[model samples]
Target chain A: MIQRKKSLQCRHVDAGSCNACEQELTALLSKELDIQHYGIDIVASPRHADALLVTGPVTDTMQPALKKVWEAVPKPRQLIAVGDCAAGCGVFQKAYASHGGVDKVLEKPDQTILGCPPDPEKILDTLRELMNS
Target chain B: MSEASRVENPYNEWINDNISHKKAGDVWLALTGYRDGQIKSHWLRANGRIDEVKTACMDAQFASLTPSLPEVAWDEREIHDLFGYHPKGHPDLRPLVRTPRWPASFYPMQKQSDDHIEWTDVEPDNPAKVVEGEGITIMKVGPTHAGIIESGHFVFSIIGENILHLDAHLFQNHRGVEKALESLSVQEAKPLISRICGADTVSHQYNFLSAVEQLAGRKVPEMIEWQRIILLESERILSHLNDLAQIPAGVGFTVAHQRGLAMKEMWQKGLSAIFGHRFLFDAMYQEKLAVSKKEQLQQLLASFITQWHKWRKLADRQQGFHDRMRGVGVVKRDDAEQLGAVGVALRAAGVSVDVRTLMPLYRHNRIHIPQVTGGDVEARFQVRLQEVEHSIALIRNALEHLQGNQQDTSWSIPDDLTGEAVSYSESPHGLNAHVMQIQNGVILRYHVKSGAYRNWPVLAFAVAGNAVADFPLINKSFELCYSCADR
Candidate 1:
């Protein structure tokens, strides 16, 4: 079990992902997972976000846009990388069009959720753990 | 049977005179065939594959076919971008995947290599052509949406609240998967192909493997084929549920959204418990399911239908929900047919182009394709709801037939495979076609035209004359996947 605090607000960015992870993320919004109840909310803007949630691998096309997004969040911002693609570039890594993983553009993430898309429960658990920490 | 088939040159005329005259069905496939300093147009007929062997030259010049077949407009532009074979009279041939930073001389898919590529610093200009007038205002949205969804750029030309025009620019996340699949074997490419669209993993894998199987002249055992159908229906059921759930989400109808998602979660949980993954990424790769486990899964699904009916009734009773969706985002039958819409969009437009019914495969002959006319947001939702019910019935039927069935489910590949084959399957979105060109067991070219790719054009048409406030509801009805379309 982890510590509890104010709800963490997150901004999600799809950097050349297959969108499998996005499905799991959407499921988190559903009543069953209900991440909002657990004090983790998905924010629309990076300025309001406490952390940046990244999915898929960083692509050459999205790299500049991603960097711009990362810069938008205020200081003391946490970066969380979700899914296999964002962690180590997964299947799309080393492709000419992709830099592979969020680290390529944003350096190492504060927390990384693994899986082709980490299950919704796992995502909640990790957030819970991060809250306690 | 082993020889490469050819259509005729001047494909525009051939299509106008011969193929269009047939009117048997719609244009299923359009791809550029690259040979020794020659470009060809390959169109898959309803009956079989037809290749226009010498349609154009290698130099940046070719007669545009988009004038006749508006659907292939995107394909022609993509061909031009990748191979430097320009379609001379294409109306809008701006870079589909390539940004301004990409050097004009560097065409990635060409035989010659300009291997070293870098990110460009060019300021992004609005590629979407906007209408200029006193009241017309261009509103740009996305490449990053408000929710957890894939990226796409939408340029809407609006006068006050009414949308005059909408131009969507996708492929922002194009990972160059086709280039990655260059020398990979059929088995080696399966993972990449399936991942092309995560929600449509099973369908993509099935279509790709079916194409390879056709090329190899191998038949899947009857029972395994039946099991494959179940896998596909399982994918269909869950995917439709997700899309349907979004409908209520778009309108802020939380109760309906929650109910829909509850059913979706219930279904996905059962899928994960029975199969290894929730999405069944490689479940088909397994030889066979244990008989007892199969029975258990069937029982679980049987109970799920009861819950689905109850939840569906509650969702159906929401009057406010129907008000928002009823007449929003209407894509008329003419526009849908002309744009070559597929899946739900096409079905909602009252065209019975369901691949299962049109070209019955495996045990799909036993299934009925449910369609809803009116081409509005409500029609698409109703179509999806009906499809979920149909998929549930299909799964149950397949399970019932598999009671005493025992068949070899071994997945194998032939040693020597050298041919080109095209396979099309109806994904939850629409027709997902995979075109593969193989030589000496290595994949030379791999191209996919997913349902999202075909139906994306319809969105622009649907949003026109609609209010800007209804854009989310309208867009939700189509449920277009930017990654799938981009890929």
Candidate 2:
């Protein structure tokens, strides 16, 4: 018998904005909205995760923590920008505090889902898309 | 005062003796208690507020309370900010959501006043204390977190996996919702309050309408009552379903999270079919929104509820789902109280305090909801599942009860001033209280206390002892909304 390994893992960095995305992103694994079927786990330790799911407009104040998490995650890891705020700062982009957008820093993202709070299914599908690629 | 006899107004003789409007200086209104699911009753001081309290007489100070009067006393500073009347020895005089530089000469509530352009810099609240020298590093999460949830920051000190101390850095830029709506008419202001917390819009609207009904001394039609209950239940089911899916994602149980999404979407779709949006904001009440066919809409809602129950049954039986959520993060009863947690978090900790039961309101008194206690992350998870099930039962009962009741959705302000009123309802997070003051057909003052003010801090405490890996797990157990606190 052969065991199949997960395609990728994620360490979430809450750069700025409220915790809605953090809750929704992590909640992807509950019995109600299972993300494991898609082979993704939101690891607390950056070193252990294969992907970095960065949710934020990445405010100036949180830049150090954001970059530190990115540095901590080992090489060859991809980035998944989940939520409209992360993708393009969403509703909060207009605010003075924001660091523009996630793309402004991360440069390239493996995926992006657009919604003030993106739907859970959209998140699962993004991981599935990663697994296939 | 005989046992079975109608008691006459004992104040009749008192009112006749000294009922004259004279020498009333400025009416000072201070909403003392905002969050704890209790209304912040304004002092309603006619001349000197202190003199009125001494002369007019009021009853009740606190009830099974967390002594949160100290914690939430910040609102008093706010009352002072906009009204210029001090809380007579308010303990903390620091800035709370407003500028210290706000002109002392002008108060926002003083009819016409200079608008202060901004807020004073928020002083970082002192983190919860922990004994020094234990290799416990203090790690602080934000008023901001990743993704779309509301804002709040948690500072955690941990000795290895054991949490040493937890304090939440709260009230990060929550626009003053309740305070701004004080001047709106009853019909004009329902939607504004409803949008206070996006997730709990239904409950907020319902709470206001119920309070309005109480204040107006008007009888709400049976149909409206039942319809409101249906909307409330729809809101509850969708919210709990949302919570159910959330638990697994926190700790990396993707399968359960996915299952939760489908289940939640199913519930949301049923709601969207009945009311336009899946979140069920406008559906909760007919607040000035024109409804052409009330009977047809009711029929549509009736059919949707039947389908929702069936869909939920299939979703609950997903395989390997429960494994991810059996006993993840646990908050003891003592800890839950100290941290001032509420809703499913408190129930999971075995406190058994639901606003509907602890403080019965509307049709909640008609239905009986059994208290559930598991006292862990899984317990919190189970509580929500149970609540969804309970919501189903309550919805069914409300629909049946609405058969011959009349519902008057049309609302108007009272022609004569009827004083002020306070209202409360439990939002998804915990207890939500609205302190409202009205005079001359306008909401003179509005102050809100959303439950998240207490829950997030307690959630920080609950996470102690759990592995850092489980921070999100413990977090979702409480699911404290920073936005609610910020607001």
Candidate 3:
């Protein structure tokens, strides 16, 4: 794992998720979780992101866009795949329109969090580990 | 024309004319309509019913229904793009699901086209139609927006601060879910259906399962029916709360936005504790709800209602929040009905067209259909607020019925299940319908027409004549899901 500073600025890319992952990711911003308190923030632009948080099965239409976003992220960036779909396409495997996961389109993800949609706590835990790394 | 079969119209009061054409084995083009509290589905082939026309032949040409129905315009365009069917005289027949990256010769929905093919990086030519004038300035926004939202392209023709016309381009995230479902078994397709849109999981799963149950000729017990109602209402409350929070966020009302999100978090956590998943992914198949868990749910809801009323009172006091939302993004009743608006949007426009009214499950209960006249952002907001309260009542009533019932919720699928059926469920967004064909327990064809698909065009209609700066606010008010539409 690449060592990161005290703060982790992540950019989320919805490559073709069903939005379940996005829902959980949004939940991370809730007052109960408040992922920002852990020194993790979801940045608006990929340029300022220390990590690229991806979700989805990486459909053919989104493959190029995902690559572009990954390239736009600065060096020493960690690529984190959230949800089973991003890790290995889950139910969408062998889909004609999908590349079947983020790894098939981009380089291997630095970390993969598993679940149909990993719970907010699980995602926050991974982010915290990245922060401490 | 003489060979076309005309089935008996059980709903003659609503459907006066019914026409259908057989387009190969077991597949036919049919029409569905609603009138006078009755929804009629005219099945032309076997036992299958389709809300709109379904032409399955390769390179088939059919008369465009958009000129008459107007609601099926998007359905036709989608049929053309995915199924290689040509709708003659269809207005604005641009690509609906297929983006520019997809090859023109390739139609993904065709059975023969199922094999994997190399995708080309070359951008294909597909242009947006915009109004041209001497001083008109066109503004284009996202297939990828600045916020944490789904992909949708909006082309606006603006003069000064007012929007003249808005052309929305969506389906950039189409993952061929319908095509993918074809190869899976009936039971295997549940996971994909549940994920069609995470927030609408229970609604989608319910619709799909209803269709499957109909195919198998299985009747769910009364206790299980009550369980289903509880699950559906819980999902409705969650969805409404999220939208309630989002609308305020659109208007920059931080207090209500944050408070609403917090309330929503509490509800999600409560659901997670009771049901395994936060979004209730496969909660439909859950066997039983213990009495203790039910009590815990009631306690959570009681506190939530208290918090909700306090937040509403505080938010209503803010005149600025109301000012930004009152007259903005007004969708008239005539336009809403003509364009086939559903869920809160339709009800807000004073149209009583909820699918739940047609279902026996809700009809057995005192389901309230909330209506407002303005059809603006504030009207939609008010409708959603009313619905959250109604949903809570619905859950409580279902729980009351389930107080002593401890029956197994699981139902077995028949081994010889084979047929096609159409089922509709009132998803939080609106009416979600699924048409599925099963051949000996395997899914042959599956088509989903979500409320988002029907309401997307209406959203574009709502945005016109509004100030350019208020676009986000208007968009948030509708809060349609792009993932479901794309799928």
Write down the RMSD of all candidates, one decimal each: 4.1, 10.5, 5.8
Candidate with the larger DockQ of 1 and 2:
1
Off by over 4 Å in 3: A1-4, B1-59, B290-292, B408-410
Q: Write candidate 1's Cα lDDT for A17-49 as tens digits.
A: 888889888888888889998889899999988
Residue B480 Cα positional deviation in candidate 3, in Å, after optimal superposition? 0.7
lDDT of 1: 0.78
- Per-model TM-score, in order, reads 0.93, 0.64, 0.90
What TM-score does chain B get in every candidate? 0.92, 0.73, 0.89
For model 2, residues B1-487, the per-residue Cα lDDT tens digits are 2433224443232222212211132212223433211323332223212212211212312221112233335455555544454444355545544333333454445433224334233333433445468587888776434444444556777787767666555554433445557556876676556545556777677667656666788766556666676777777776776776667778666655666666666556555555765455445555322133345445645655565456455446753545655665677777665554667788777776666643333534453444656677767876787787677777666656655425354655576545656566667777666656676668766666666665665666666667777777777667665545554
**A1-133 per-residue lDDT for model 3 (tens digits):** 3446578999998878888888888888877788888889899899988999888888777777778889999988999999998898578856788888888888899899999889888999999987887
Using TM-score as the measure, name the better of candidate 2 and candidate 3.
3
lDDT of model 2 at residue A43? 66
Query: What is candidate 1's lDDT per residue for B1-487, written digit by digit as tens?
Result: 0122223343445335424522555454545546343444444455544433345453657766676668877887888777788776689898787777666676778743426676567744437779999978999987776679887778899998999999888888887887777788877887788788888888888888888988988767666676778888899998898888888888898877888888888888898888778888877766476344677777778788898888788778877788878889998888898888989998898987777654345444465666578899999998998898888777777776665546454546875789988787888888888778899899888788788888888888899999999988898898888777776
Residue pairs in collision within model 1: A2-A132, A3-A132, B7-B51
What would the per-residue lDDT of candidate 3 be over residues B188-240, giving only the tens digit for each residue? 88888888898788988898888888887777777778888988999999998
- The candidate 3 chain A region of ten consecutive residues with least summed lDDT is A1-10
Off by over 4 Å in 2: A1-133, B1-134, B287-329, B334-340, B358-371, B402-411, B415-418
